[model samples]
Target: MVAVRDYKTALEYVQTFEEKDGLSAEQLMDSSVRGGLTYNDFLILPGKIEYPSSTVTLTTKLTRNITLNAPLVSSPMDTVTESEMAIHMALLGGIGIIHHNCSPEDQAEMVKKVKTYENGFINSPFVIGPNTTVAEARGLKEELGFSGYPVTETGDLSGKLLGLITSRDIQFVEDDTLLVSQLMSKNPVTAKHGITLLEGNEILKETKKGKLLIVDDEGKLISMLSRADLMKNQNYPLASKSATTKQLLCGAAIGTIEADKYRLQLLVEAGLDVVVIDSSQGNSIYQLDMIKHIKENYPKLEIIAGNVVTREQAASLIAAGADALRIGMGSGSICITQEVMACGRPQGTAVYQVSKFANEFGVPTMADGGVQNIGHIVKAIALGASTVMMGGMLAGTTEAPGEYFFRDGQRLKMYRGMGSIDAMKKTDKKANASTSRYFSESDKVLVAQGVSGSVVDKGSIKKFLPYLYNGLQHSCQDIGVISTAILRQEVDNGNVRFEFRTASAQLEGGINNLHSYEKRLHD
Candidate 1:
């Protein structure tokens, strides 16, 4: 025979308890019995969940001027980011920083590719000459991964469109010597170039064609719209785009040397939106000078500076007009800088300290390395990182540079740190990314701070990124935070709580005493 308490009585009783379950961010980060802390050293306490996980907002700032729908950034590693990776990342609501491990012309071309990328429109569609053989068109289909090509007299965009060719037109043709002009469809449906995307969609639906060519008054093709692109647009509604051009945002890394100034001019001409002053140690006079120079010369380009891990380093870059700070040193999966140099801070402490300071200036901070999973990304944001930069995490994806190789019956791809000896030796001093970052291009002997390795194939980023986004959204829901901005605000006000985990507590939090297990992150 027990009596249940009324709702008012239960509420009052719960309110009377003054002690909380966990520590505040100030209490957790300020208490330094140990030297430094990492993401595994703590956990965030769960709060009341009143909304659905699908409703959580993951939007955050990439720099002082750039806001993204997602807080994920691909690192500026040669194997991690190129034009392909940059285009897809911007489409998925994050941004990629193109690496400068190639010639200036090549890097600028990559930047141009990203700048010209449109979601539903294929600008500069591939064209073929009317005399092109069936065998050559098949070879092109295999190489370009697409089947349709517009036939032109000059085999380029400058020529007038004569006809169109598709896979279905030649699938059953037995003669390999047949010319495209013999099998092409003449007078394909088309619209004027000035038509809106909605009108283009209507024309495509009404005509029931796989592609709709937009042409000028002279009948020269301006662009092509594909049904596949339309599907992609519907799938990714939160795509990150420029407010003016509606083009995908693009960023590229540049060295701090005087020669880089000329390289940067070419990139600026290619429509680079942001420039990351790539450096291993960003507090040097060289980096500060470069920051100020870029600020004075390229006044409109947003700058993200540093591979810094301390408040002092962050302050110098921010004062020199860095719109954003890249935190973490020697914390990458492939990096051995902490072991060889012994001068870097632990990632969790570094992010918390620098982000806490940068927030005062309204400057955002990017936690640059050592993030292995969604939980690590959540912890980084909880500690105050505005975004997380990943290299290895994104290296093996389909969009990343490099072809897949098989070993031991498992698919793998190359993954390396910028400090690796292999990376430094891959290129000469003219355009080498690793040697320039290490400031040892002139040194007779090169020391390695990172290793070259391979990661298991992570498949296409199209499937992978949505998985990460959904996982992050659910994590935020479990924490009772609907948005990253509010989460940080609650942390500052001492409402969101944290708890330092002991070594045994960390072990207990994971699977224990398991003989065998299979972990599947996504389908």
Candidate 2:
């Protein structure tokens, strides 16, 4: 069975004039590329990792403080951007733009979820004097949800940090009465205040530890680094840079009719980055008035206005001091604003128009819907969208809150639309054109459409994020763009080509007529 020639030579020998003249891609339908089908004839997209390698900075400068890793964002939908999802996204280095389809308190809980998942705050981390007991450390971890403690010489950390104690370091002790000093990690790796993050990473990697202690000039314990803190913005993992500001950035969705000031203030205190003044019909006096009020009072807080579909609407929000814009008009899978009332633009075109104008004023635009997969993400980025807001796709995940229940022999989460019937009380939340107005006075409960519902399987965002990250990396690798900025540049510079496709061709190729290999390894 040994071959006399290599693959290239063997292929040349196997080629027959009959095969070339008589066959097409359609004829082979198996292993060949078939008739003029080039990689350019179809679009391969980027996921989260394949960022442009040209060193174009992608820092989401918010409130002069917090910076995110990837500019890519998950949409704030009822079933998508929840507490679990937010924390995982943050862990994976992207931001989970939490949805606000629920009550104000619930939304606040979502914020707390991200900050609390794993953190190193100025206050309230596990702290203990050098002479504490291992039993005490174990108790602290079990009860308070903190797994380890920073050991300082004085209770106030005024002296040098003596060492550190973790549950694993203490678990095998013969005596529960053993002192923490007996088991503590002594003279643990420490970082000076001005050290680079890259240097910090190396120290952590060398020591094989979760965090490092930050010390002042005199070796006074200044702060602690949580393992979670060290892992952020995975896309553009930083070597190191000191954050001059302490502000945390978050995005919120507010109603145009009754966005409460008290709630707004609470969000500002909770580290809200931008306020998305959400509305079905955003070009009205009601939304404009709300924008004016927010700008007047919370002058320092960044406000992003939207659901706007045109240049004029985008213009109005921009003029009202919008820090960013959300562009889409009835593109949502569950939205019926356009169908029932006959208003709104095609989302693709809407993104183009709004993003074009919004970019002119330095306000970033988020393409809000119609993102069924990673391709939509790439397309939105190419069309000048600063980011994408996904809902249905990201839903049913751990960060997306829900209890799993049996449905059609599978576990799933409740995934539904906002303007959906569940969102509408059969009466009040119901849409009435008399209640619905497009460019004028209107009604129809205007929302009354089919109460269609779908169920999705519940899972954690951790697994899902890696899929996106790898997918984006492979996409960029194929296109020869190492970064998102570069990919966009290639697309804009005509270095990219787009090809529309149908399901048949996509599925027809690859190993066919193979055995089913019916076997269950795990199940």
Candidate 3:
């Protein structure tokens, strides 16, 4: 037996030695006590930095083949993303998935509009026959918000370019039944089909013409150039576009029903870049069969599968040839899946686990929900997420689908989940009973996995997204990483560390004991 003094000396040695080690990402997550971990539960440790935040790069892949200058994606919810939102997202270096709650024809047209918005030339400009009435032209102008129509002998694009019609020609017309030919500008300025955009702009400026039709030698319309487009000179350096056609990249969502297959054909014909198999639970036989069918039929079209939270679910989708995995289940601000079904993991844990597993197979993963702030975005990227998909974060902006209203002196926009009762009711009455947006259609009574709500106005994506992009760069600078790829690598190698925040520490971190405060995102 050792002496009592020797035991005391050993105890003293243990007490004197201290451990200052930080927790790895995995350690911080796996050490969660009883409850699941969330983005707010922990904080990333600051690292050594030698460069400015402006030098940081945020480029990351949105899919196995598609890269985004910013690792951001707008959600496919109807109230969140549509043609306008999708176009703006692409312009800002992210992508948006057009929601499929509308008719297939309407959805396809939306996709077409995005692809047609920015092009070297408008290959298919809106055309009206010489017989089109002034009433019809006015209706077109009212509906499409443009009055410049190319008047062809026949209504078809391949017909002879008779002349051009502009607001100037129709503004003074009092007769509603008068044909467009009577009011059209005869012998309008024309450019040869092979003329470059610069040359076409020069002709427009010289002739003071609002519309410049590019025609073949036979005088058939080949393309058209707009004076407005030239004057705007909008340059989206990071716009997502196809390498071959240079059309803006667009995606559409589809369910696992038989009708969706027909819808997919229409979307693909409209130059859809990707298809998301939209479902709350993605491991169903319906989803698996649909994924296989799409991969077999449209091999080039990338498929983003699932709202899965577990590694096993991700593995199944990955084996089914999913190009990217959407991680998060009922983690949205409007989602109540966890509360109702008693299922679904926290968003942070789900993102980390699914992304880590998907990365092994060369498949990227997106954090689908629960992105309340910029810090949450940085945390998701550090956890190996290639892109973060936002619904609520982007919902209240100017580009969002719904109109803003004053609610108790606050300007707000309507934002409802795809699974909410309001969305289902507005979608289709008959289909609401059959379709399952949130996996609750099998129940006798429809139980909503999400709620209808409103978010405060956040101005426009033009200002908000840049703020997010800049804030993310600052976060990367703080982590001592210059790019999302490097950040993920450091996280994988246990170089990027984290620490769990206790209740007291969390209180200390926030603005506690304050009577009031004003929060402004950016100057």
Candidate 3 Cα misplacement greater than 4 A, ranges: 1-21, 31-35, 130-140, 168-212, 230-235, 430-435
Per-model TM-score on C-alpha atoms: 0.85, 0.67, 0.86
Give the Cα lDDT of each candidate: 0.89, 0.60, 0.86
- The TM-score, computed over Cα atoms with residue i paired to residue i, of candidate 1 is 0.85
On residues 278-390, what C-alpha lDDT tens digit does candidate 1 reach at each position? 99899999899999899899998999999899999999998898999999899999999999988798999999999999999999999998899999999999999999998
Q: Report the Cα lDDT for residue 380, model 2.
A: 66
Off by over 4 Å in 1: 1-8, 17-20, 31-35, 112-118, 126-195, 213-224, 269-271, 403-411
Best by lDDT: 1
Task: Put the candidates in TM-score order, highest first.
Answer: 3, 1, 2
Candidate 1, position 409, lDDT: 96
Candidate 3 matches the true fold with a TM-score of: 0.86
